[model samples]
Target: MNEVMDVIRLFLPLIVVQLLLMSVALFDLYRRVSVRGQKWVWVIIIIVINLLGPIAYFIFGREKSSEY
Candidate 1:
């Protein structure tokens, strides 16, 4: 039990951060008119690929804005 608690404590913050990142990515994806590739695919990547998923979407998925 002690070891389990230790592991959870170590990973809890990372897990929380990961969820936060995924939530932000998903929300951004929803608000945008376009992304680099298919929106559905990016949604899957952001939701299913864990820490790297949202990062990948943010880095590679977002299309350049024309509003600038």
Candidate 2:
């Protein structure tokens, strides 16, 4: 039980952060008009790729201001 608690304590913050990031990404994805590529593709990437998925969406998926 101690070992399990230790593991959970260490990973709990990460899980929380990951969920937060994913939710924000999904929300942003839903609100945007156009991203760098297909909306469905970004949704799949955000849902399936874990932490990096949302980061990737922010870094590469979103279009530049000049694009609009």
The per-model lDDT (C-alpha) reads 0.92, 0.93
- In the range 1-68, model 1's lDDT, one tens digit per residue, is 99999999999999999999999999999898888999999999998999999999988998878531
- Candidate 1 regions exceeding 4 Å error are 66-68
* TM-scores for all predictions: 0.91, 0.90
List, residue by residue over 21-56, the lDDT tens digit for candidate 2: 999999988888899999999999999999999999
RMSDs, each prediction? 1.7, 2.0
Question: Model 2: clashing residue pairs?
Answer: none
What's the lDDT for residue 10 in model 2? 96
Where's the lowest-lDDT run of ten residues in candidate 1?
59-68
